[model samples]
Target: MNRNASRILAALFGVLAVTLPFFAGDYPLQVARNIMMYMALAITWDMLLRSGQISFGIAGLFGIGAYSAILSVIRAGMPAWFSILFAAIFSGVVAFVIGFLILRLRAMYFSIVTLALGEIFRIIIHNLHDFTGGPEGVVIQKGVIFGGNANSLYWLVLAGLAVALAASFWFEKSKIHFALTAIRNNEISAQSSGIDIFRWLLLAFVVTSAIQGLLGGIFVQSYGFATPDAVFSADFTLLPLAMALLGGVYSTTGPIFGAILLGLASEWLKLKIPYGHLVVYGIIIVIVILFMPQGLRQLVRRTSHSADGRSA
Candidate 1:
């Protein structure tokens, strides 16, 4: 679509999103919250993917943030709101330190390390039984944020989604886009062209990790607890990855579209085939990868181009 048309549609969506909880019932709002969380995670995943590095550490950073937020509240006596921000900051700092070491690796080497890191984090949390509540997890004694109000909770998650969207758009529109595209297209060429490849990669990694943590914090605060299995669930990593892939990678709009479709479908599957939903979900993802690897965005674009050619 043209710039003006895109803006108008975005504005309409924004209005609808902001006003959703006001009119919609709690169930719809809850569904929207879940979708927004995964959408944010998917966007963050794509952000890192732009640098030609595939990461499997979404759950690690997410679980870290979840624990950080809850622990800050319970141990440090931090206010619920401040704890969420603490989660983001702590996760960003951790990513910054870890990036220096792992950013040097590329491709599957980097991907494997990231995946291992998530498991390592979970194991560490498991051993810290006294502090982290071990496998049983920790709960917020003060109750959930915003007094467990569904509207407020919906808006909180929406705010996290907005942050992710804004950051992704910024990456897309600014010089970072050129830098990341160059790095992804060719690291050697990007380096020769005076792009600081490592710096750009690190920046993307840190930013995305921080956003994942922020979403995690929001998630834990919304539910009033954090468990290793729950917060660091494979779903946190896999669902977002699948959503990004199914919608289209390397763009902001792709994840949004993917998350909405997959998220709703997932909810329905849970209701219809709760015990085997994930198996069905995995089958769907496999079908998409095999048959529609380029995802809905590319498919739609190709269709539009063909229709235009026919008309012309």
Candidate 2:
């Protein structure tokens, strides 16, 4: 799409998003907030995937941020705004240290290690009874920013989505795009072309981790409590992965589209089969991977092309 068209579409979407809660009821607004949060997570995950790195530690870093934010608020009595910043920094530092070791690995090996790291984080939190309240987790007495009402929480999540969208757009448009594309295509070639593959990969990892952490902080604050299982659950990592893959991994629009579709489906599925909704998600993932590997975005593009060709 042309730049003008893209800008216009984005503006329209922004206005619609802002007006969503005004038209929708409380339940719908809550669902919209969840969709935006997952969209942010999916986009951030795709941002790192652009660098040829597939991480399973999204929930780990996310949990780190939640714990950091919660602890900061509970222990130090810091303002909620400061907690968000602290959580992001904490996740970034952890990513920097972990990326050094894990970035050395490639593909499936890297994914496995990251997954293991996530479990390790959960176990650590589970055992830290004094600080984290063990597996029970911590609760926030004060509400989220802006007094923690549903509308306030919805706007907070929207702001996070906006930030993630801007960062993703900048990354796609800047030199980092070339660096990550090069790395994704061929690390040797990228290095030969002076891309500093490790540095770029590390940068992507840290940035994505920080964003994940920020989202986790928002999740905990919005709900007013956190537990190791809830914060570090595989659901966070897997759902976003499925959303990105089902929507299309390399493009920004893919995750947003996928999140909107799957997020609503997920809610309805839970209502119908609360215990088996995950099974439905798994089935959808299987079908998409097996038949529509290019994702729903590609399917739409192909359909549009066919229709245009027929008209012509």
Candidate 3:
């Protein structure tokens, strides 16, 4: 019964999202787009996390996508939409190459390397001033991907979110989930059970990186600019990580729930703290880890179980 209610709620939300621009102004639509974009990022993060690997390099691939698409448009004379495809493929290829080298690292070592790589990507872009516009950033001469139409741009981001959601759901339904679960529970057991650990891990990494790159391309094309600081900001890494953690680490619905709640509040928080919002984000992460590591999903389930017990 609760599952039915959740499905109904999701349907209603989808309807509202599709019809939003009819009554809402561009600002509200843009805000919704921002939420959807971050939600996609959070979902992609959790997808790779399912393999028991923690990655802090979302901004790395994201920035790669932004620059790759935009640079292709400018230097290679590709259309903006075509550049998005190139961005995804390029990011996936980079991930595939990098995964071969780094996936062998265990636990926090892998995490720390990813964090370093995010900054490394940023530094490389910052130094390539001749083509990339360096730290000053590049302003694309191209118009927005959807001709700057609020409704179209909103739908474009929504489509990307839909794809991420579909992929997450598909992952949940596939044997890959079991393999990843076994891996997360015990790599030795998984290996003994015949799981090719490195192959699955590499697949997850490449797929998630591609999705992140896809979103980044859409973002840069829509916004009409990309700078190293803007694209590779720690906010990209931290906020999505927070949303995924707050929502739920191993489920599709958790990140969606977290992103909507926190993404909405984040703008206000940034305004209030200005220079100190990252501190607030850090505090939230620490609190969630200490008090509710399973996140709001666990809380919801407990409430539902308690109500059932009371009725019984």
Candidate 4:
């Protein structure tokens, strides 16, 4: 019964997401796009977390992809559409090269390195004045993809999100799942079990980095510009991390649910308490972490179990 209900809900959501442009206003579509983008990011973050590796470099890789896409279009004369693809490949390659160096670091050591890498990426871009337009950023002379049509732009981001969702689902269902779970549960045990820890961790890092880069490319193409500060904003990392934590980690549905709730709540807070909204938002997140560390998914499961017990 629960499985059937979930399928029905999933189908409804798909229909609504696909048909949103037809009925929703431009503003709503824009907000939906933002939510979807972060939702994708949250899923990718959780993907890596499944390996017990927490990355703080989501913004770094995302920014790399954003800049790569924009620069390819500006300097290399690549098409806007193709540049996004280039971004993903570029980011994946970067992760693959870096993985050998950093994937060996476990726990907070890996997390700190990832965080610093993002800062390093930002600084490099900041100093590249002639080619990258320096800290001021660069704009597409040709303008945004799709001529900035809101619906078209929304769909572009949605497509990126769809890729993220597909990859996440694959991770959850494949042998990769068991590999990561074993690694997370006990790296030593996993190693003894013939699971190459480095290999699986590297794969997760590369795949997640690639998706983050893809999303960044989509963002730049949609907006038609990329600034070091904007593209490398900490929000890219923190918000998605928070969303995944809030929704629950280790599952695709967790991040999606978290993003939807927090994304809408964020907009509402901004409108109602523009000056203090961030403070309130942070407080809310802290409270959730303190009291509901397992997140909404786990909370719902507990509630459902309680109700069943009562009926019994």
> Can you write out model 3's per-residue Cα lDDT over 1-312, one digit (the tens) per residue?
267776787788789888998899988898899999999999999998999999999999998998999999988889998888888899999999999999999799999999998899999999999999999998878577777888989988998898789989988999989988999999999999999999999999999999899988999988988999999988788899999999879989889889988887877787788867678778889988898898888777777878888531
* lDDT (Cα, 0-100) at 147 in candidate 4: 96
Task: Between candidates 1 and 2, name the one with more favorable lDDT.
Answer: 1
Candidate 1, residues 1-312, lDDT tens digits: the string is 433644686688789889998799989998899999999999999999988899999999999999999999999999999999999999999899999999999999999999999999999999999999999999898899999999999989999999999999999999999999999999888989999988999899999999999998999999999889999998999999999999889999889889988999999999998868788778878988998886877777776667667431
Q: Predictions ranked by TM-score, top down?
A: 4, 1, 3, 2
TM-score of each: 0.96, 0.94, 0.96, 0.97
The digit string of per-residue lDDT tens for model 4 on 1-312 reads 254665686678789889999999998998999999999999999999999999999999999999999999999999999999999999999999999999999999999999999999999999989999998999999899999999899999999999999999999999999999999999999999999999999999999999999999999999999999999999999889889989888999889888988899988888988857668657767977898887887777777767777431
**What stretches of model 1 exceed 4 Å from their correct place?**
1-10, 310-312
Candidate 3 minimal-lDDT segment of 10 residues: 303-312
Worst 10 residues of 2 by lDDT: 1-10
lDDT of 2 by residue, 93-211 (tens): 99999989989999999999999999999999999899889988888877566776788889888988987898899889999999999999999888899888889889999999999
Query: Highest lDDT: which candidate?
Result: 4
Q: Is candidate 1 or candidate 2 better by TM-score?
A: 1
Question: Which portions of model 4 show Cα errors greater than 4 Å?
Answer: 1-3, 310-312
What is the TM-score (0 to 1) of candidate 4? Answer: 0.97
Native-referenced Cα lDDT, model 2: 0.87
- Which sections of candidate 2 miss by over 4 Å? 1-12, 310-312
Report how far residue 307 has shifted in candidate 1, in Å: 0.4
